[model samples]
Target: MPNTVASKRVHVAVGVIYNPHGQILIARRHDDAHQGGLWEFPGGKVESGETVCNALARELHEELGIVVHTSSCTQLLEIRHDYTDKVVLLDVWKVLEFDGEARGKEGQPLRWIKPKTLTKYAFPAANTAIIDAILKPRDSSFSSH
Candidate 1:
């Protein structure tokens, strides 16, 4: 019988972390993993029953040695992108308050670049929407959720 099952989408919690200098944090994916060798915001998948905020906090700490301030976290955007092999549902968040100096805990290279220069770096196709959102003008305040 011909297959009719739909592919499951990977739900990822992405963080657009801003430093005190207004720079955004990005990390390079391992060359062997999916979307390898491209720069991406530091984040990872959301486990079942995990809130987006919880997932973001977990991923950022695990991947980038930083603790996200959940109260300062805000949903920036949600994107659903389909690739040739996999679909992804990206839950993007703006993380203004965090603790510790950000580093790549997974041994990947990390970059803190001005948002205006985000276009210069090569990122996954799914990240295009995130780049656009970051460039758009908006109120950047640290209000509690």
Candidate 2:
């Protein structure tokens, strides 16, 4: 007989925030949560009836205490990964402009490091593509505005 189990699907909105100094922001997940203790770009799960941009803004604010200017935010890429228990779809965005300081409002540790140094930190498997997209040279398709 064939297996008939299906994993729950979770939609997440992720932000790759950058400062004027060219450093990117990252956060550590709570040690008790799924994929815990890994460094990740700050973000959270998208809620029902919410657009990815809206989710990004809300999650960023709730997680980092910063207001995301959705108009200036750019969709960098999307990634879907399946784990043993669940499937995650990551809607990644490039957050170049925002208001207020970025801090861990939820008590997670935060780090601002150069893009080249991203490899030094540990991230979930789903974030591998996000890291690649961040490290790759920005092409015309990716706009700063």
Candidate 3:
């Protein structure tokens, strides 16, 4: 049978939203959905003709009820991953400032966790890079001996 899933590369915008307390926000993917039951940074697919940062700001507002200034977004990293069904290019950003409280606007479970404790939760394979990127600075501050 022909592959039902589209082979097109998907562009996604992910936000590692941070609060004043040094905690980052995460959300649980729907259990029955793709990469289900995994904790992921909140984001969505970037529609055609949309800039990556614009998409990030749009998704954040639509999914979390927050208005983010695209100009304030810090481009952090980009990850490309190919899953069995499709391929995705994840454009990750660090969002430290925004207006409004973040809630599960989509009814998904959301929580805040310290970056150093991210390993305690289960995440999709693509997220490993993000986790490492988030920890690199902290990792350097610790004594290696």
Candidate 4:
């Protein structure tokens, strides 16, 4: 007899913490955490009853000790990838400003790297496009009065 079961997707929040220098922040996952020792944007899973933006704010504060105003975050992209054990949907955002300096509150190492240098780091599969998008310059249009 064959067994039937369904796999549930896991939802996570990710932040592209940037500075005026156009550097993006990356953090090393704790050795004991999932995908440990790998580098990624500083963020984590969204808890129940929390909006995506709210989760981003919370995760940033918890992981980096920075308090970001939820309204200031801009939705950058969403990534969906499948792992052998589970499917993950990462909601990524770009935080332009926040309070306090980012520290590895979780005992992880953090670095701010230019977008051009991101390719040199080994990130989870889902972050590939996110990095590309971050490197691309935003389109701007102006209207003359």
The list of candidate 4 runs beyond 4 A from truth reads 1-5, 137-145
On a 0 to 1 TM-score scale, where does candidate 3 land against the true structure? 0.87
Q: List model 3 lDDT by residue over 53-140, tens digit each.
A: 8999899999999988666677778899887777889999888888998999888999999999999999999999999989884443
Cα lDDT tens digits, model 4, 16-128, are 98887989899988789877888999887898999988998988998899998777788887888877767788998888888899999978999999889999998877788
Q: Which ten residues in a row have the lowest lDDT in candidate 2?
A: 1-10
**Per-model TM-score on C-alpha atoms:** 0.89, 0.89, 0.87, 0.86
How do the residues 1-145 of candidate 1 rate in per-residue lDDT, one tens digit apiece?
5432336668999999999899999999999998799999988899999999999999999988898899988898899887665677999998999999998888999999999999999998879989988998455433443
Q: Per-residue lDDT tens digits of candidate 2, residues 1-145?
A: 4443254789999999999899999999999987899999988899999999999999999888899888878888889887776778999998988999998888999999999999999998889989998888567644544
Query: Relative to the true structure, how large is the alpha-carbon lDDT of every model?
Result: 0.89, 0.88, 0.88, 0.84
Worst 10 residues of 4 by lDDT: 136-145
After TM-score superposition, the amount by which residue 62's alpha carbon in candidate 4 deviates from its true location, in angstroms, is 0.7
Q: Kindly indicate the candidate among 2 and 3 with the higher TM-score.
A: 2
Q: What are the candidates' C-alpha RMSDs? A: 2.6, 2.4, 4.8, 3.7
- Which pairs in model 2 have colliding backbones? none
Query: Clash number for model 2?
Result: 0
